[model samples]
Target: MTSPVPPADPHRLPVTFRPTRTRAVLIGIGVALVVVLTVMSLLLESFTTGDRVTFITTGLLGLGVLALLSRPKVVATEDGVTVTNLTTVRRLAWAQIVRVNLRSGDSWVHLDLSDGTSLPAMGIQTGIDRQRAIADARALRALVDAHGTVHSAD
Candidate 1:
């Protein structure tokens, strides 16, 4: 008889990046706006189907933007890194990354690609806590150092 395969360990999965306070604020604001608008709409005695539709549509659009804020994140695995932004999610291997830059005046940590292009890691922003952002950037740099390919200074 064939031996049974063992289940993989759950703790060994890729470590997810820390959540941001800015994202929480965004979600809070969006939810608050939606609630206030919904309450107001219901209070209006002259509310019609068209008005309801408009209110719902506006709420959805606003909430969608807030949802995007919650969606962005950076995950670091042994294989590579995953960056999810507002409009896109990119998976990049260690070899594809050139550098990680987190500096003053920048809104977020940006990844320099080996292809001479750059991508912003919106998951790490400098809005809420500057110290925390710096720390996260350092941690990400450590990940890059551990798994990324090294290039010679030509």
Candidate 2:
């Protein structure tokens, strides 16, 4: 059973973009790996101090990777777009945006800035689900067109 999606605000742009499958798979794998590692570490009967440290560090690393995978997103609102990539989160006003690009060969949607800096919209990933990615990119372009004075690349 699926719950109905809430209606979007007419005056505001859509909320956010997300990768369909890749993120779920990655998050599942990350959580599973961390759990397995932790269980094995705890079950071990003997452990040196160094071994304990290494085991804990490995689990923490898995959690860190999970955080990274789950964090990236492109959020749009009446004010602007917020892009959260692997290591950075940037908020840009509509006027600062130059274009949104999701070319056929590109891995993800890219936001072109007026400053000439291009930022990847990791939330709208391609290759994993091509059609969905295309549709999302188009929707994002529509938002940009409606709220901002910018042209997107083909």
Candidate 3:
């Protein structure tokens, strides 16, 4: 019998790494909202009937999921950083980024470009997303430091 070859080494560099936030917390929150709605229905039954509870619960869950998942996109490439919005994408050459404060506020990576505009990193606003995103941020910072010579940060 022929032996199978193992998969190529997973640590290969020059690959595009995407930062992602987990949906567990959001899902949990959705569940909690449903429970809260159910409880509220029992207490505030003057307006909502028994049938409305089901509809309200389902609607709330859907809205929660949608809101939680609707986030911005941040990408790093050999050239520079890219921030994406709901309908548009912004690309900043490493040179344009003056300072990147990977700390505080609205749960996002804060960016300060040379022109005096500040924006947050796209993903990992909460939960596991924070941990993973911080790690990736470190890596991206390192990569930028080593390669982005023309681009400086303070």
Candidate 4:
């Protein structure tokens, strides 16, 4: 049997769930890459102006991609939940979310919607930190239970 879910923290409303370590690491790498490229472009005597610009531009592009990778987040509020993935953002009401799941071997939390669709909540990924992901998923599930309408079995 699974452990009981802890109560949702009411004071933590407007809470944001994200991969903390992954985001920090990605952002740190991005910043370091940009700085290194910029310094190289300025210090290299053999590089032409065009070459320097190209190097800086390439670094910036790489940073942009890393930024995108670190952008996933799930925000929960009294109104509803807002899921922001790599390239998409979706908002759903409490009633619209039927369940929140983070099963074993799953990479991230998946929200089962009343519309019969499942949305990948990349913000709570298990790969980087499994315990934290499970806690976050349980918290989200508690929130859904507290706020969402209860459906009767047919």
Please give the CA lDDT of all the candidate structures.
0.75, 0.79, 0.57, 0.86
The most accurate candidate by lDDT is 4
- Tens digit of per-residue lDDT, candidate 2, span 33-144: 7788777777787976677678878977987887687777788998998998888889999878888898879999988999999888888887567777777787777788
Clashing pairs in 4: none
Please give me the total number of clashing residue pairs in predicted model 2: 0
Q: Which whole-number lDDT from 0 to 100 does residue 32 have in model 1?
A: 82
Compose the digit string of candidate 3's lDDT tens values, residues 25-144: 555666677777666667765755756667576758675665556545666666787876445568878777666556643465666767788866655343445555555555555655
* Model 4 misplaced stretches (Cα beyond 4 Å): 1-12, 150-154
Off by over 4 Å in 3: 1-19, 23-68, 85-88, 104-106, 124-126, 150-154
What are the clash counts of all predictions, listed in order? 0, 0, 1, 0
Clashing pairs for model 1 are none
The residue pairs in collision within model 3 are 109-121
> RMSD in angstroms, all models?
9.6, 3.6, 8.4, 4.1
lDDT of 4: 0.86
Q: Where does candidate 2 have its weakest 10-residue lDDT segment?
A: 1-10
Please identify which of the two predictions, 2 or 4, would achieve the higher lDDT against the true structure.
Answer: 4
**Cα deviation of 48, candidate 3, in Å:** 18
Candidate 1 overall Cα lDDT vs. reference?
0.75
Worst 10 residues of 3 by lDDT: 1-10
C-alpha TM-scores of all predictions: 0.82, 0.82, 0.53, 0.89
